[model samples]
Target chain A: MNLTIKATKNNTFDAVVVGSGMTGGFAAKELTERGLKVLMIERGREIKHIEGYDTAMKQPWEIEHRGKTTNVSAEERWANSRFWGLGSEEVVNHLTNDKENPYIEKRPFDWIRAYHTGGKSMHWGRQSYRWNKQDFEANAKEGIGIDWPIRYEDLEPWYAHVEKFVGVSGQKEGWDVLPDGHFLPPMPMFAPEVHFKKMMTEKLSRPVTIGRIANLTQPQKVHTDLGRASCQYRSKCARGCPYGGYYSSLSGAIPAAMQTKRLSILHDSIVSEIIYDEQKKRAIGVRVIDQHTHAVTEFFAKIIFLNAGSINTAALMLNSKSNRFQNGFGNDSDQVGRNLMDHQLGSGAMASIDGFEDDYVYGQRPNALYIPRFRNWGNDKQTAYLRGFGYQGGASREGWESGVNADGFGADFKKSLTKPGPWSIRIGGFGEILPNPNNRIYLDSEKKDKWGIPMIVTDAAFVENDWAMRKDIIASAVEMLDTAGFKNVTSYDRPTHMGLGIHDMGTARMGRDPKTSVLNAYNQVHDCKNVFVTDGAAMASSSCVNPSITYMALTARAVDYAVKALKKRES
Target chain B: MLGGAFSAPTLMAMNHWEQATSPTIEGAAFSLSDTHRKIVAEIAEMIIPRTDTPGAKDAGVPAFIEMMLKDCYAQSEHLSFTEGLASMEQVKFLELNEAERRGVLKYLEQQTKEKMKAMPKGTPFWRLMKELTLLGYFTSEAGIKASFDYVQIPGKLENIKLKPNQKAYAY
Candidate 1:
């Protein structure tokens, strides 16, 4: 098992960043900008910006089977097929193949992942919200898990830094539960959404605002200088925005990093293990397996950034077995793959609006309206759930496809479909799932992958707090819809497993204590300060919000800290 | 966290995408005979006859359905479809005049509605054929261009007051 792998001297760099995803792209950009020669290793095929978006340029009619997922695709892509939008022929190409990249699921876990250059950044739901002050102190206040080492004030500047570069579009709502950030021109709200917002404010005393999204409403100089454009309003964002209308890694950070001329990226290179120096007690390099030839190569670096997503980041660290740290790299606390958490979803309510038959939006707006969490924050503490949940929903006039199940055919049916149907509004909740030590992922040592690396085994599920929050998610959503004078209001709550949210976090949690956590407040591993995990893996707790922006902020902060630390050491 | 949670509202936006693959209708693998192809084309035309917009037959919906049935549908559904084709052939439905073909379809539609009410498990062949025809036609360029307003990129979101008879947006 001890096959000797020689370190390639030519591949040495100041920093080696694993995974060219949202955080990895940021790490590459920030590190390279800070004067470090950074090497970014991406596990999937190289997906170039704009030109690599094969499905974006395609018209509805141009796609085969009318963009339907074929029978072969359903059988072969069983893991990804369950994801509503991801399984389509128009989008499936970007997703990771389940058969090739298999993982053991103790329970039903929907692990939707894209391993390409941009990773899930290209298809991410760009709802950027800053974690509130209360969110940082929640774990300690509630006595749930270990407290977050850093507070909102610590991350506020970094959040603003990312928001300015990313070009988030939103209105300054002055909400405390969800802190607002630097924003571009907000996308216009639909008439129904406007009505719903008013009703929620008047009746329930909850703030419903247009979603603060990463989609560029108007291209700022920061974005235009990078050759990115404004939003086209096509709503074909998940296909990968060709116009760079959205802030994907492909359109944003990757290009910014390339501009530095200090960043070098290697695609199709899967990081198997981090080469730890037993004598020095630090990570020196990483072993990579070429996805094409299965050739193994070692690239040495002064510092390492593990931004290879949450589960995979844990998997890589756990697989990195050194004589000094036998449990795993920087895992003296035994917290490398513990405390897995994801947002509890698949619960909400919807209703049909009676009027607004003539009102319609002209273009396909990519973003929706978001109701900030009003439960268990400040004076609104709830007895049912430990943490709060937010509602993200919108209203739209039903279009032609409604004719699919309708009775009759010919001219009448054609006319029926041609004219839009009644407007309907619905809101679903993304509830925060409390992190549990038992809900974790580990490497199945007995099962070696195609690259001879151990496969990941996930044992995570929703706890009582999650289900209780889901009930409130449904109840609150229904109450809002009904108060808005919506007819045919219906509440829905379906059982869901972790990873379905695609916001999986908290495996290698950050904390103040080296004995209790894997990473420090700066996202550096406790025992091994040279190696950092700035991705979702380093999250101490899952905040009830989209986590990518926070990850970017953390990556930027971590890189700044690491660069300063490295500079001081050199002096 | 807050953004993608609008799963239900977004479901409407995805409605057009879902039309191509209805969970109830699984396509099958079977070649359409020349005689059966003629009958299937006529049936499609009956469901979406020529009007201001191109009908299902003109939009090449019959061929689309044949491909869908062969590649997307289940084996049991394939047998049911082909057997229904044989029964129609016995009555020489395709050989009849356009008016007579319409009348034949109307009768089948009535039978299908009654059968659906009596037993919900088995979908009537006529209903499946109609659904396929509708999917194929609407997804076709001719059907979309003629019936709905097709805009690849509107560039900006606009507040519009739609007239009662205005065409819906084709994504």
Candidate 2:
């Protein structure tokens, strides 16, 4: 199904954005807001903002299995079957069926995904934090991986810009480790969390504050103008917030992009390849495949933005082989799918508190208490690891789910189950996984997925640096809880494969030298300057923080640069 | 404020969840005999007997337990569970008085404690019966309304003092 010149001409736009997720949503908004006619091609089906959140309002009783998987779902979602609560009736619709979208794992890796319009933004943990000045300099100072082309100063204003629109709710602590952002009033912490925070600061000198979440506690004109409101204090955020309480691609940026007349979108369209013109020395357009019809179509544009997540974005570049990029698109250094990194989790501690028995919560607060990175900082430099880690956790009384193990039977047992159990607090560390060139993803041509594309084989694994940090993560957590006078403190460290954190980054890293990285300072492909990748694919190093907010900031900055470059050329 | 219910965006948002076929309904291969089903129901009621609030029987937990076991469990597991029930039937458990039935359940509970590692998330027969009863009773509409505190939308969030004898929040 080759397109004629007339049809190709009709399909042209000023710019094309691929894979509408966290970054693509912002890219479309930024480009279209600049009066550039942008076309967004999403492989997943379209879902409208508030209305698409079908399970958002569903109560536990409304679900057939009462928020657990049925026999059929347990088999269908076998890959993610071990992930508790993922196959529940309310939350399952927002996630991708792992059986359908298959990938090869050289080492055990969990490829959790959401392929709809908003992508995983619909189901993000919503813990937002900035990668501060220290984070940008860690690689250069340690001489580990290649230096990041851009610094925190380069993204400061862009962070402020996106945070204003995204409506982050956080406490502004003047710590150089984690920079402050433009935040709404932070959500209230639990009483136990408050007590724990006091003890932590007084004893351990670790700053414990409320998590800087993406949920809006107070909606400003910027958010309310887009028809989004404050969070409803309902903890069921993962099902997609009908009130537009928290930020997602569908609830925020995509709607804003569509509000402008310059933005057009096509759904169920997978971008197969980027059309690079050898003579023109730039990307002219992209070739797309219809997800259902298997029909091929080419849409011409002056510039292209690849925001198909980290691994998928690299897979696309590797698959888009041509005369200029025979190895892969702009993969002159063979770095299109290398240096893959994610935050090393699966290590932390939990304890039962003696107090807070008489205390209970009024609403289901969806946020957690954050103990920011204290190690390897100004006053507390650590020999255990190079970078540091932060803790995201909450303290609350144990609910009825713990009753399965509790001893009980008739009326007495039934009456006991009606009330809460012991007050327990749990915290997990999100430690930094260093960018090792050996920890990478390469496309397996021999094994094609259900889509007829090459299955991405993840050879990435946790290195010695990550393991060292994990030791600290567990030991530090136990020490803190024990010192705070908590009862029966227990630690946990499960075997975690990469991609479990879902903050996949550094696949197509941005470095100063074209010989070592795929993208440059402005998030553009080093050789193919017209094509940009502002997702996690462009990350040079894996900082110990949630990466979505950074992706939004970088996408906004890159779009600003790209639009100006286009204008300069036009003039 | 959900404004403009008839607006273009609202109309587009009407894209409901596509997969409506209940997984249990679509793939329920196991069926319990009437005698086996009654004994299962009696065991569930024994585990969570009706007090002031409705027990497992009133909450329609017997049916839920069967549905879970039928569709959710493997054929081998279903056979194993039914075979365990046959052992109880062999003892003429249904003909016993209430006190005798309670004593028999206490003995099975002790036996289950010793052999719990044999079955993980899926379970031994007595443990499975008890677990299913608790799960079905707690999550059902009857349990939520009568036994637990059902708050549809608590608009405010805070750490508050617990009221005496306060019911657990049905999340």
Candidate 3:
């Protein structure tokens, strides 16, 4: 078979955004909206907005496995196979197959990834929350890693800008710890959750509120105009919503970018390296390998945005070895892949409630009740831990799946199964992991993945601070459940591996000093000002919250700064 | 208002099923003899006996159980199942009278309780058999759609009080 050598003109665009996930989608939208012709590059195959959603409307009987994980899948998705419902027969497609997209793990880092047009945005939990002023000032106050260049006040307007377009469904509780956001009507809570909230407020002096999800409870004209609708409450969100019910790159930002006609998407183009010009001292373009053809192509742009997730973004920059950056592009400080962190989890409590037999719910609610971070804050500063943790969980009547363990069968068993079992509530705590420079990811120069790209070797692990936080996390959770009058309360502190939380952050952190960090305040590379990285890689600290909303906010904020810089240079 | 005809999870399940099994149909690999299948079917039927609703056999649960055991269960679980079955009365268990069959099952149930005390992981044959039977029966179309209530879409989520004799909606 003769493989013909193919080379074309340096594909030019005003801007190039790599990896069309949460941040990339926002970067494309913001850049294109600013009259810049942007080219969005995605390594995965293209999945058209609502039309590509295949499993959004399946019935109970229609499911073959009925949420059972198979032996084949267990062996294949070895790292993430334990993620309970994540292995459900439907949501499997959204996750990266561990066999194909392999990464070396010195320690057990559950590097879960979703490579597609929409990326993991199609399967995000959509738990949106704003970081308080305290979160930005924590590192500097505690003398941990480098301090964040920007504060909460700088990102507040950008958070609103992203929220208005994304249709955030949350209640505004004017707490200084977790800032309020522009919100649609909050999703109604379960009756048991309401009772638990009251109990938490009375006894624990804690605020328990509905999860600030990104799903639209009430679709504004902006969402509807993009062919998206309000939530249908099917709770099969991980399978991808056909209704465009939730905020995803496909249903939200990508379509908005395409509508402008200035945004062009190139799928199945795996970016190999950022092309840096030695004379210019700036990134001129990027070289990509065709996922199917194995042919290489170069695409040039005035500016480049690396939104290829945390680990991959760091790996790409580290792999881009140039004459000027022999160690790696943007590796002047040798901090390209240092300071890797994920939220420390796998600790919490569960209990069986006595009542709520008649107060049961019908549909699968797509959100959970969130108990915001209380420890290590004003009036509640804890010496046990430096940062804090938050809880995300729900209450429900045990369904037929619970019958897998119970005794009985025959007519009596069938009759008993017709009604619900004991009402049970479970909550898991997500704690902040301190950014340790030693906990880092470096590219394995020898081992290559299926794409011929160097496999990323993760040496990151949770430190003593993370373990200390987990102790408090379990204690606080047990206290709350016990105080709420829940019977048979049990607490658990399971072994949590890094990257299992899927909130990977702080590989190329943002800081004031160019010598300390790779990216500046505006997410621009200090060495090459034309390139910006607005994903989790820019995070200075792993705040105890889902970081997708923050990524959207930062991308929007960075685009404003980048576009203004480009304009100033032209003038 | 949940008026959509399609369900995302089911469609994804169907797609996954197609991809995983490929040309082979689900439950094709019974991994059990005809005699073994018959005994397994009878045991499953006895566990979920026919009353107002159809039994496990009628719902085609035996094949599902065999498939699940073969494909989903671990090596230790498989060993326990095969060993447990070998220990049972092998003289045409399915051919026995209903009274004798019930007596044998009752004896096995008692044996399981005694074995559970000594067995560390307690891969008690009865428990595994019962668990698989319930999972296979309840998830089947005959069990959920025919006997139980199944709403394709509830339109909007709401909490409702159920009257006496009302069946719980199958999710």
- Compared with the true structure, what per-residue lDDT tens digits does model 2 show for residues A409-449? 77787778888777899999998888888888888969887
True contacts kept of each: 0.65, 0.70, 0.59
lDDT of 3 by residue, B18-116 (tens): 333212113233266676677788889888887788889888888888888877777666666765555443433565666556655655665567777
Q: Of the pair 2 and 3, which is ahead by DockQ?
A: 2
TM-scores of chain B alone in all candidate structures, in the order given? 0.75, 0.77, 0.73
lDDT of 1 by residue, A401-474 (tens): 66655666667776677677889887899988888999999988699888889889999888888877887888
Query: Among all windows of ten consecutive residues in candidate 1 chain B, which has the lowest summed lDDT?
Result: B13-22
Candidate 2 structure quality by residue, lDDT tens digits, B1-171: 223423442222222111121122222357787888889899888777798899889999899989888766776556657756766666556876666566566656655676785654336678678778888988888887788788878777877788888877765
lDDT of 3 by residue, A239-306 (tens): 88888899999889998998888888888789999999999989999999988897889999999999
Best-to-worst order by TM-score is: 2, 3, 1
The TM-score of chain B in candidate 3 is: 0.73
lDDT for model 3 comes to 0.83
Candidate 2 docking quality: incorrect, acceptable, medium or high: acceptable
Clashing pairs in 2: none
Backbone clash count for every predicted candidate, in the order shown? 7, 0, 10
